[model samples]
Target chain A: MNMEVAHTREEDKDLLKVAGEIDAYTAPELREALVPLTEKEGNLVVVDLENVDYIDSTGLGIFIGALKSAHNYNGDLKIIGLNERVHRLFSITGLDEVIDIGEEREEAK
Target chain B: MGDAYLRLQEQYRKILNQYLENKNEQGLYHAQQFSKKVLENQISPEEVVSLHLSTLEESFPDIPKGAQDSFEFLLEVMIGYGLAYQEHQSLKDRQRELESEIDVAANMQQTFLPSGIPEPEDLDVGVLSVPASKMSGDYYHFVHDENDCLGVAIADIIGKGVPAALCMSMIKYAMDSLPEQRLQPADLLANLNRVVEQNVASNMFITMMYGSYDVRAHTFQYAGAGHEPGFYYSAEADEFEELSAKGIVLGIKRHAEFREYQRVVAPGDFIVLLSDGVTECRTEQGFIEREEITRLIRNHMHLSAQEMVNHVFHELEKLQGFQLRDDFTLMILRREV
Candidate 1:
């Protein structure tokens, strides 16, 4: 029910490695950890969903909110390491096309 | 209504008079029938108790105080029960009226859907949609324009009931008004998004997949607005690959973009589109995986497109113990040329 976010600073971006289910109840914690990283101008934020097992629509909504916040400051948000289940959520909601679902090196374009 | 109440009172009085006169089996039968009439009219228990006391007074001018005290005790208990019973009856009447309205809306929803499957050349298109409840939260629309184009859309509203039906109506009208060229998958989804975002509430969200089969080109171009990912079966590989596009659910953002996807179909290839009800179908063992659905489709691949679709539904329905938890929709478009 609760998600854990491990923040690791890289060259110019913040990597938020996440674990546990990202559902309605646990999505806010992810939003808090994720949105602030995008608030700073041009900060590239990446969420590693490798450990995530499941995510409901509310979690998808949070990603949308975070994507909006990141874009507002000309910052970029990318998600990588989506397992099959989480990946299916992105594919189902068509978010995979909107958000960058790729590796850390595949940043910006 | 007033006259009916008066007639009911008169009948109750007559039945009581006959019962007090003979206390016979025939009188008892009349009393029982009158009790049923009182219930049918939703007459309160207090009315019956009061009528009984008054009838006793009239029948025996020298009625004893003991009998009178006993009537007062019954009246005291019936007062609370009578009020509750009347309130319950009122609620039942309101519930019945609500159901009637819902039935009308459900019929309207059915009428709005495409009456017959479009018989496009060289394409075997099969569609199946069943609602778990009276009003389906899922909707499918088909548009076969004059330009050798077949457009299909499948949508699922997050919530059900009247609001979902209204949204579906909006989608139906919007699709009807769209020009043929604008019926392309991505364009249609984007246009629908603008319409829904403007008219619908913030909380209301819809997921849709819009696909068009270009008959001459043998291409299926499709797009999604956070709908369930569909599948494409490659004849050469004999494998079912999921088809997906990038987009958010509709009515979320004003300027959300939907990514379009395309697949060129060779002879014997097919595309499968569905709602989450198919992917997330649950049984006593729990949710049957999408892979299981694919297996079922593969097992029934020899049947005609429509039969295959129906076979899968009945199979899923069986696995679900004949109780579908959500609206089930599955569509298949096969290239027969």
Candidate 2:
């Protein structure tokens, strides 16, 4: 399925709320939207994957690259609102250990 | 008349031999230089053709009556040979240029790697890296923070050669620019993902493992971006386990997330990180299992970290007949109580 990203700014962080399936074909669009946000020095970024139905390896890669970019500027990127399946995917791949995933939906913000 | 014809034939034979053997511009130029001699000797193309026909007739006395046709064919063959020789020379020159370009790129890639492994207090670290070809798609790095926190990263680009090298450099620069506050493994990878997504081509991706070990806390915090799972050796249990973290590869999506995992390392506990080149080592029976790597590490566990890595590499190399099919990187982080 096609992916959609909704962007907003909250406090000092760039909030990107993404919905839809993220796979090989649609991951680039998400990358295009998120790359510029990480470029600014010390820009706090938050990604809400609550509505994301599926995430493949490609989609995961984009998030990792974005996190690196933010860190380069001394900024931070946090992921919040991962659904059960998505969280399980992270556990399976062992990415749960590498990124900041907010367990409670309220804590994500 | 006979003497002059013999002299012409001998000269033509000598020129043909020179051109065929050297197959260079100089040889062709010599032939051009001798063209004037042919004119001065009043020898026509027909005379040359006749000389060739006579030589053929000597070998086949009962030859067919198509002497003139045979001469024409021979002339065409010579012209074709000359053209092929020039094409071959140009191709060789182009190949040489390409080889040199790859050499330069390979050298540049090397500079991006850490010149020497850092030896932090109370920690033993070792690394071994080998490219499958002149260039590698794998990269490993180490950064020490002011608080004595050591950050280790091992990454693999999706492809090899110049593009992969360029991607690796971007990773290095991004890591270097990371702010102190963002030194956490998860934060570091998140920042790096943005850099990679923006700079790296859409067709390419990267897998990485970034970990930070706090000397005082004795905790190892790490994150993985679709990279291969490393191995963890727990001295208390005297067993080996997989250091598996979940994250996707870099450059695939704009807003993705990676989960971080942490473990408290005790004395005699160590972590081993490696690229797929190590786990995917090919055998006649297919890929070597992940357990093989753990076994190798276990067998050499008594040695120092560096020597252990060396021994594992040597043994794997022996298994593969000393030929690596992919970029190989192995790293070890051990704590001494």
Candidate 3:
């Protein structure tokens, strides 16, 4: 299915909530939205993939690219609300070790 | 009047013959030089059409009254053809430039592959790699260290062509610069991840399986960074087990960690590693089952390691109608009793 991305600003952090599949075709949209945010200095970019049903290698690549962009600007990028399958995918690829993954906001507090 | 018509027809035929016969650059140069003179003389398109139409009128005084409109329509068509020809020529030139660029990128990508597979004592190794296009996103390297350990790594970039080739090159140099981390699979991948995250573009990442097999210890230690899971075949028990590990792909995070998995190689046991091109092989009915690959490996287990790899490749290629849609890389390591 096509992906839907919603952007919102909470205090100093930028949140991008992504829904639907993030594959070769739809990942570009997410990249376009997140890359600029990552480039901003000291910006905290959190991508919510809670509703994202599937993510392929291409999608993973986009996230990596955004992460690098954030790091370059001394900013930070985090991912939150991954489903079991998506979490397994992140773990399998060992991305769980690198990216900041947060629990649901309420659970964390 | 008839004489005048015949002479005009003769002149037109002569010009056409001249162009067709002298199709070389010299002929074209002369034509271009003549056209420059014509332009200097200020010959308008309407005047040119009128000049031909006047000849037709002179040749046949009794010509149909509607012929002027026909000639004007013909002039418009000719103008359209000229514009189309110019467009086509520019497109051909652009295509040539693109072809040469792809050729250069393909050559550079070739250097990233292992020059030769190292033959470690007590182990047989085989490798088959092919790219679906001019540039491949797949990469494999074998590093044999002084400690009787062989490091095997297979990686696939997310995209293809020059970008992917560049990523593979970065991975190669990164691995080379980290000589101390080669023995430990998890450490090697973690280090490689940092290199990739720091260097590669945000839109690119690599999935890789890195392993080191110590011949004296008979142990294979491995780690995966979102790479395809390989299979371990036990000839003694006649079972195929997967070499699965947890990790995210490289370049995704600065501090990505990969867990290392280890297996003690028993005699008659073989490890098979492959890119997604193998497991994602498409058939008329869609992707073939991963079990089919395991079955192919089991069927060829009796042969030498190289032959076994070849057999599976041959069968898979046949299934794909000899046309692969992605980069394919398969490597096999076997312990001979």
- Write candidate 3's Cα lDDT for B236-308 as tens digits: 8989988877677887667877788999999989899999888878888766888999999888888888888
* Minimal lDDT window, size 10, model 3 chain B: B38-47
Chain B only, TM-score of each candidate? 0.84, 0.80, 0.81
Q: How many residue pairs clash in each candidate?
A: 2, 44, 8
Docking class of 2: incorrect
Sort by lDDT, best first: what order? 1, 3, 2
Q: For model 3, which pairs clash?
A: A65-B202, A92-B247, A93-B226, A93-B247, A93-B248, A94-B247, A94-B248, A95-B248
Better of 1 and 2 by lDDT: 1
Write down the RMSD of candidate 3 (Cα, Å): 8.4
Candidate RMSDs in Å, in order, are 7.6, 12.7, 8.4
lDDT string for model 3 (A38-88, tens) is 988989999998788678777887887787789889999999988866776
Which candidate leads in DockQ? 3
Model 3 misplaced stretches (Cα beyond 4 Å): A1-26, A33-55, A64-88, A96-109, B1-66, B77-81, B180-182, B321-323
Q: Is the docking of candidate 1 incorrect, acceptable, medium or high quality?
A: acceptable
- Write model 1 residue lDDT over B1-337, tens digit each, in one string: 6887778767767877887778899998898888888888777898789878877787787889999989999999999999899789889989999999899889989998788988888999899999888888889988777788888899987655576778888888877887756466887888889988888764467899999889999998999898888889999999999887668889777888778888899999999999888987877775578799899999999988999999999999999889886788999999994
- DockQ, per model, reads 0.27, 0.12, 0.49
**Which candidate gets the maximum lDDT versus the true structure?**
1
Fnat, 2 decimals, each candidate: 0.47, 0.21, 0.86
